[model samples]
Target: MADTAFHSARQRYADLGVDVDAALSRLAGISISLHCWQGDDVTGFESSSQSLGGGIAVTGSYPGKARNPAELREDLDKALSLIPGSHRLNLHASYGEFGGVKVDRDQIDVSHFAGWIDWARSRRMGLDFNPTFFSHPLAADGFTIAHSDDGIRGFWVRHGQICRKIGAAMGAALGSPTVTNVWIPDGYKDTPVDRLAPRRRLEDSLDRIFAEPLSPAHNLDAVEPKLFGLGSESYVVGSHEFYLGYAIRRGKLMCLDAGHYHPTETIADKLTSVLMSVDRVLLHVSRGVRWDSDHVVTLNEELLAISHELVRNDLLGRVHIGMDYFDASINRVAAWVIGARNVLKSLLIALLEPTERLRQVELNRDLTARLAILEECKSLPWGAVWDEYCRRQSTPVGQSWLDEVRAYEQLVLSKR
Candidate 1:
């Protein structure tokens, strides 16, 4: 019955000049990098006790949060098994395994992440990295890489330098380029008297951090921007304009996090414009409720629009997609599965869009026809095709995945 439904849906799409099989094929190739912090509520396995700060907070006291690297990996394995496509793991410098020894952010080396590399290698998955700029004593004032103190700023610069090398090493070992992104929480709680000095220091710090040239195949660098956060409500140093101009001038990937903009603004529209100046982009797909709350992603209109822009403009090759949400209110592993599956679902729907036909209508000044086709596509049988995709991938075909998660919770998470 499922096969029959898919076949009927395939023909329905075929009539509209859309290729179902091709869409599925392309989706299979796209990998969304899942953040590891979601599993443990951002409490990394560091010997030093650093409270979660830096203008961001994780809510909910969900039970069974992974306590250590082993448990985190175990939880990640279960979540990965449930998700439908191949994906990469995004790691923070703070997550490095330090065998009962204290390894500060600046002192972190690839040796610290050797276990992670082997783990990723065994799973045949690539790794992406971020320099942890928060939750440390040095970053307590909500400033890193842009601190007024030279020593504090240099410490973060060294951290960034070492992180890029670690990212490059992971990429070279795994035969995939690792995108090492930099996002700082530097800003003022109250409006600063002089904003110009901090930005100048930040630019200089970034220049020194990225001074060493590395192969793009091994490691790609990206700079992320934000609108505001808890502590830095008045001012944020790394605004979108700052990073956009820097990315353009430095020839690096610009990371446009979905939740890093105003509630009314969406990163979907920024894709085409950013791509004109930068060669590549790194997207942190997230959902923000009024602020950067980091809610789990769902099949929302903004998500659909993002996928549509990627597919319509044919920008998949140039854009590296990654999930960036942490909702610990529900089951932690389930949050991962839900957000990842929805991201893939949005991409699949966009893939099934008859973009060229709509483009032809719009180019020919047929606005009515264009709008009609767009509205008509909403009622298309995309769900049947999604089920077929799940079946073909040997993943659970729908809400059946929820059952597996429930079983895991009862058997595994409950004990933890």
Candidate 2:
């Protein structure tokens, strides 16, 4: 019955000038990076008592959260087992395996992340990295790179530098370039009198961090900007405009996070413009309910639009897609699988669209036909195609994956 449904769906899509097989093939090639922080609510093993500062907050205390590298990896392995296709792992510098040794952010090196590299290697997964700029004593004031004090600014800069090297090492080990994204929680709660000074400091600090160049094959650098954070409601130092200009000028990958902007603003429309200026782009896919809450991603309108734009513009190869959300209210591994599968589902739907026909209609200035076709496309048998894709990948189709998650919770997470 599943195969019969897929065959009919394929014929329907083919009638509309879409190739279901080709779409599924392309979807399999796309790898979404899963964030490791989601397993532990961004609570890295650096210090058990470390407070989650710098405008970051995780609500709801869900049990079975991973307390160490072993548990985190175990949970991650379980989540990846349910998720279809090849995927990468995204790690924060704070999540490095220190083996009970105290390694400050500035002093962290490739040795700390050697365990992670081996883990990824064993699973044949690529790894992405981020610098730990928040949840530390130095960042208590809600500033790091843009700090008024030079010594504090230097500390974060050194941290970023070391993180890049560690990212390079992981890429080398996995034979895939690792994207090391730099995002700082540098802003103020209230309106600042001198915003220019802090931005200047941030620009200089970023320049220093990226000064030591590494091979592009080993590592790719990206800068992420946020509109506002919890405490930095009044002003966020690394605003979108700042990083857009910096990325274009410096030839760096500009990371456009979905939840970093206003609720009404979507990164979907910005894809074409950014790709024209920058060589590459990185996306941190997340859902923001009225703010940058980092809720688990769903197959919502914005996510679908993002997927459509990427497919339409042929930007998938030039873009690095990664999931960035932490919802501690539910089973952590379930959240990972849900967000990842939703992202892949969106991409599959986008790929299955009759883009060429739509383009032809637009070229003829037939807006009516274009709109009609788009609306009709939504009601197509994309779900059948997705189930087929999941079956081909040997992952659970439909809600069956949830059972596995629940079973894991009973056997593994419950013990925690």
Candidate 3:
């Protein structure tokens, strides 16, 4: 059918049964956050305000394949040009392999790490502390604190404290803009395994997060959860979905990852329905089958369905989307672009929908129809799509990793 013919057809359907404009307008209000290289330092992002985030290294901790602090900060500086008004930064930190003992975080890069903190401090940006613990290492391959000996538990706690201390200080200096996002690749294997010790260890460590010395600076702790890696072994990974009512009872926040669910889970609608019940939400989203592998991928039909559900449900507040990816084989920036564009487009799909009846049952049909609506609204610029999509986000956390490039040292001995 011709454009006119198509419009007429849509009108004919509406003339009999649907209220397209009302539905489309209702969905127009939905929005989401997109990650990028930190463009500049601009913390103070309010979840209610719908903020954005930027980062350099999300998967790797060390400097070898990762961007040093200075380089990351610089990349963020440039990212700021494109991502102004954004203020959330996911700090690149190191972690141990799955099930394996978390590495000597002390041995990891320090100067750049601290530099990123200092940058956040100076620029007044919020830092989503994400220490990298790739699953590729011996420690990550199905090993976890649960299976470790008492001695290993001691070692892990000590390391956790050090990272927490730094994290608290950064949060305090930045005030209300701290986001300590912790996602451990911890779980069990198919075989029978010890569980008590790891459960105790993780529980004990988590309690410390809310303990005394409140770090008034870093009071926000977004415990993010994912399934594919360790959920196979451990039943209690992050427990955001499992422990929402419990965490609320404890006065802590709950972080939910959109991509962490199996395909059967209607995450978006559930999130919208549940957003009000939690203390806070730290969003970890990506394009995937929901039942299969979940690194960042281009947001496709399956992904959009949930995203649109996220829109209709109104869960953009108290939520920040993360690009949870780990592909050592690809250029990091390529990964970044893929994540960014997908998020932006997902939002457009949501907006283009007839805002009225946003239930998924109708969204698929409406989205296909709305593209024509957008194109036909002749005076509107294509850029309107971008504006409609970049959901409200937290403040921007951009920094200059440039100045700290040459800095390096052993954090272990420094403690001495």
Candidate 4:
């Protein structure tokens, strides 16, 4: 049932005595990003991108399911029904139902959240959720959840509490290690002067969420940061990835999203290396064009094959590869299957690469060399390097990120 080409390399290696069994087992933890339930078809998004990346890092059923306040359970059943019997669910995007911004606590009366747990338990599936706030123009305010404006301030906390609660419940589920995903869309264009004041408040709020006594089962906290350009000034795009390490009062790990960096930035290796250097590197995965979070991954077979080779050689922990696409055209089920196959195939091809793939390490963000760096840290487990990571990750949110927004907002108010 796996892609024939994806398997060809493995079969060939089997003929050559390259330990195929070990490779497949090592590639277990695959996850995907779904934007379907959020009202975006997102079906063709992956199809289009996979054509380019050759299907590098993508796996699992990213149904693109969004939770609606009115019928969370209804949508849950519909999405669960859509996931083919074979695959697992990962990276669920919460695009508040009926076009309300964020998950409406008012509409979440019935425990649709419970159904996902039951669904995973029933089919032995895994689920990863990303909290998204749309419909609220203020979301552009981004992480400065500290904004004291009438309708803007505190969105982060309101939504944050929900994430923490979900994390607790998800940690209790079987086969679901990655329970939380945080991505801030508030990118600013101008610079602000007084940023530290707000940054501290945001960090403290985040601490409250992560410090909630962990359930252990819920292990990976997915931290995906993105960058935006074509702006009048600089915005806090990629800096927060490492800042998380220090701010997490409770232990937490960072997830390096492949598409979140700017075009020239190519941050996969940089973020991963930074996280690894400090030791908050819990998971490694990616999607999108090399430049932006277009979410569409290259569908080229050769590319997928090559990426697979990288994963095999890199020793990446939990390969949750799946398309981070959000558009409509293909069936959710088909898109998921296609994306999954591309990722699986890519891994197979990676095995075909010469064993010395490590020798070719370039200073890229995918952290090709850092895998070796991590390998050398055998003497120091996470308990060993957590403090160091925390120290490096402890960047306080500066007003600069906010300054970008403040300048724009002030201009808008002046015009009004």
Each candidate structure's TM-score, on Cα atoms with residue i matched to residue i, is 0.99, 0.99, 0.61, 0.61
Superposed model 2: Cα runs more than 4 Å off = none
- What lDDT score is found at residue 225 in candidate 2? 93
lDDT of 2 by residue, 174-255 (tens): 9999999999999989999998999999999999999998999999999999989988999999999999999999999999
**lDDT of model 1, residue 240:** 93
lDDT of 1 by residue, 1-416 (tens): 99899999999999999999999999999999999999988889886465798876899988888888988999999999989878999999999999989878888889989989999999999999999998888898999999999999999999999999999999999999999999999998898899889999999999999999999999999999999988988899999999999999999999999998889999999999999999999999999898664899999999999999999999999999998888778999999999999999999999999998999999999999999999999999999999999988989988998998889889988897
Model-by-model lDDT, in order?
Answer: 0.93, 0.94, 0.47, 0.43
Highest-scoring model, lDDT: 2
Backbone clash count, each prediction separately: 0, 0, 52, 45
CA RMSD, predictions in order: 0.9, 0.7, 11.3, 15.5
TM-score of 3: 0.61
Q: Which stretches of candidate 4 lie over 4 Å from their true place?
A: 1-17, 25-87, 91-110, 137-152, 194-198, 229-233, 237-250, 265-268, 278-292, 299-314, 318-323, 329-333, 356-416
Task: Find the 10 residues in a row with the least total lDDT in model 2.
Answer: 47-56
Q: Across residues 207-249, which tens digit of lDDT does each residue of candidate 3 receive? A: 6534555553564565555554433534543444434654565
Clashing residue pairs in candidate 2 are none
Per-residue error (Å), model 3, residue 222: 2.2
lDDT of 3: 0.47
Worst 10 residues of 3 by lDDT: 39-48
